[model samples]
Target: MQIKPLIGALGAELLDIDISAPLPPDTLAAVRRALFDYQVIVFRDQKLTLDQHKQFARQFGPLHVHPYILAKPLDGHPEVLRVVKEKDDRRVFGEKWHSDVTFLERPVLGSVLYAIETPSKGGDTLFANMYMAYETLSDGMKAMLEPLTAIHETPVPEVDPATGRPLEPMRLVNKRGEHPVLFTHPETGRKLLYLNTTYVTHFKGMTPEESRPLIDYLCEHATQAAFTCRVRWAPGTVTFWDNRSTQHLPINDYHGERREMHRVTIET
Candidate 1:
């Protein structure tokens, strides 16, 4: 397989490997290495079935089952989240910047998203390099962040997407945890910004109001133009991103068209 850089900051496209079938041992190793090196990797024209998609992701780690999710697991595949946005839907599932499920005690290693159907245009996903975000910070900022821990939570939806049933508070408690602001990538041993606006509410010893300014400042700094890359989607395209080293946002610009994708989150 050939790997081509998608952008200067991060992302690479791997060509000539069909993920529908099991990849050779060396190719799988190469794929893993590319993900670590580039932060984001895409495979085009690989029409992977749900099982095949899970199979490929399982090679990296165990699949994650989202806790108390709004979207139902696709059919019988508990590990796969079938993300769909209809033509008339006002909002998409992941409209904000986040590393998937950061509230979990052990956040996922990464995500494997396979496109089953995509809008004709304008449903691109943007990934920001968190490693670059941490590296570019001033020494004083890094020194301050090194000893800080951010509180994260999974924000529950008001209603279930599949049932339209109003969710009760008892069934909707947020899953909360704490993680260091400057996290060391477990395998790569590199520092990365580990904060996300979606889940993180405050620092360990600070209130939300007290932490807002610094949180906002860091969020703004982390996602600067030079640290990001945009990936366009296709019917058979698959993308994998190292969640520990990146934050991603899915554009909801395809309001007039339908888009469907299957996602599997791999454990670290």
Candidate 2:
């Protein structure tokens, strides 16, 4: 497969590889290397069945079932999560920047998302390179963050009064964990800014009010355009992202259009 860098920040596009079929050992190695180096990889114009998508993701690691409290599993495939936005639906998922499932003690390693349907305009995903976010910090800032731990937690979802179901399909059980503010990547051994606006509520030993300024500053600094790449989706496009080294946001600009995607998460 030919790998082309998508932007200077953190994404690459893989061309000429059919993910539906098993990859040769060398090709798989190359793909893994590209994923580690770039943090996010995209494959466009490829069609894959739900099974094929799960199979491809499993090649990297065992599939992870999202805690049902967070998202319901897709029918017949407990490991796949369906992300849908109806034409009239007002809510959106992943609209805020985050590393998925960080509240778990062992967060997911990565995620594979295949676009089955896409809006006519304005449903792009943005990824920020956390490695860059950490590396560019002043030495004093790095020193302060290196030894600090932060709390991550998902908010409880609101139930709809009419249906008695969650207004959204997902809910967080309020799962919480403490993770290093500057996390060292398991494979690359590179340090990354690991907190997110969505999941990280505060620093371990501080009040949310006290943590506000620093958290807000880091969130804003880490996602500056210079450290990010945007991916515009098309039907049949598949994107794989390393959750450990990057944070993503799904732009919800297409309010009245339909978009659907199937996702599989890889266990770390």
Q: Give stretches of model 2 more than 4 Å off.
A: 68-70, 159-172
Candidate lDDT scores, in order, read 0.90, 0.89
Cα lDDT tens digits for candidate 2, 1-268: 8999999998999999999988899999999999999999999999898889988998999999887454657889999999888787665776688889898888689999999999999999999999999999999999888878989997665863222455665444567888999998999998899998888888988999999899999999999999999999999999999999999999878977899999999998
Prediction 1 global C-alpha lDDT: 0.90
Candidate 1 structure quality by residue, lDDT tens digits, 5-80: 9999999999988888788999999999999999999999887778899999999989999885575588899999
Give the lDDT of residue 240 in candidate 2: 97
C-alpha TM-scores of all predictions: 0.95, 0.94
Best TM-score among the predictions, by candidate number: 1
Tell me how far the alpha carbon of residue 165 in candidate 2 is from the true structure, in angstroms, after superposition: 9.0
**243 Cα displacement, candidate 2 (Å):** 0.4
Positional deviation of 140 in candidate 1, in angstroms?
1.0
